[model samples]
Target: MNPAGDPFLEACSKTFEDQFSPLEVAGIGSFGIVFSATTKSKSHIDKLGTPQHRDASEGSGTQALQAVKLCLPGCPSGIKGSTSRLQAEIEAMRRVSKNTTPSVRHLFAELYAFNTSNEPWYSMEFILPGVTLQQVFDVASAASYPFPEEIVFHVADQAARAFQYLHDQCRFVCTDISQSNMMLRYPGKEVSVMPDLVLIDWSFWAEASDQTTTCAVRNLYNCLAPVFFDAGWRCSRRHDRDSCAASGVFHSC
Candidate 1:
């Protein structure tokens, strides 16, 4: 659907006083649709606060682009927890932002603002000039060029640190770990310089204390651990580690 005609976008425009101008759909899934938008006025940017890694060009009278994810009502088919899930995702982002060290925090996108009043939605930092690991793998596969061992290790090491923070400090488990969830910031940078790996999509994160099964399992068969296939196995920090390892192997193969 066109952004202008989308009900969710219309709601956002009305609710936020047209501060955000929708550019295009960044992604769409069963739970929500993420729109790439830019701030219409300086006041809006002020209200959301400046991102730490924003380029100098953006500060030079340029509209700052962001990602807005609007919840889809009654999502996940029969399930009706879309709004709650979105809230959880926002809370997780905020927790990580407040507690992690600078290096580890940069690995996760920053949350700007969120609302659950009517058409639930949230805005977050948009990674510009970035490429998902999935896209990189696809290109390499098509060209029959495997990524260098050093590059692989670099990505893996950064990802491992991020997961460790989420597990040990934040006490959360990113139930979803896949190639598409990891992005290489500044992919055009010199090969000698390792690009920062930014992890996205916290839609499936669960707190370590929560013993309940998660809906994330439904779509994460390839990355999920074998224990997840058991009848009543609950999510844990190990699940994320296993999933990360599986995703690494899957993408590198």
Candidate 2:
């Protein structure tokens, strides 16, 4: 460590104001604990942050809700690879959001990362009034109803396009694809039209370098939430066809 310390280190330290209203737990996993919140002002939005989609008629004062993830309190301070992993996530998210397309721009939320030396956290566009695919399946199950296969396929179709944007335009791979990673924003709205689907989680996504090799980049896949069905899913993975196949969204893993 340097004697005077690095002044630029403070640049990574972020603080929140009353502008952000904390809601509930978005999720909890080895990756980190996610919390939901709402932004009170447009200024709160980071430089590369995604402004919440608002109807032009609605005019000004459009607040964007967002989700934030932080390391568990009890995590060891000097634990191996902790800081590096969080930094990696921030880098990957920045790269993906850098070259977003018109249709797939909303596929992932804008990342706002910070490192306060002792703790690390990052915020993303808060997806409100939404439910994950897992929640949808559970509710349908509890009601003794089947989750509409048509709606499922529609969401999958959109998600496939998102994957195409990620792979083709961004030179990135979504190593983790699953129902839990898929979020839907629809309520008091008809499902007749396709609901907007947002893909979350970038813990394992990799940026493909120009000198990418098979075993180094193309062959890797997330083993979590493996829900493979008979749609040539493995063939796509084995032959690196997954980079282009939009059909993988059906299995979602």
* lDDT score, candidate 1, position 239: 56
lDDT by residue (tens digit), candidate 1, 1-253: 2457767566556555466777676777567667777777666555545453344226576666677777765345212566677777888888888788866766787686777765545545555557776777666656666455455556656766777688779877777777687778854223336777787888777766534123333323343222122222232455565455435533333
TM-scores vs. true structure, each candidate: 0.70, 0.63
Model 2: residue 38 alpha-carbon error in angstroms? 2.4
Worst 10 residues of 2 by lDDT: 223-232
Alpha carbon lDDT of each predicted model: 0.61, 0.53
Tens digit of lDDT per residue, candidate 2, span 101-162? 66676667556545536645544544545777667656654565644445545565665566
Q: Where is the poorest 10-residue window by lDDT in model 1?
A: 224-233
Best candidate according to lDDT: 1
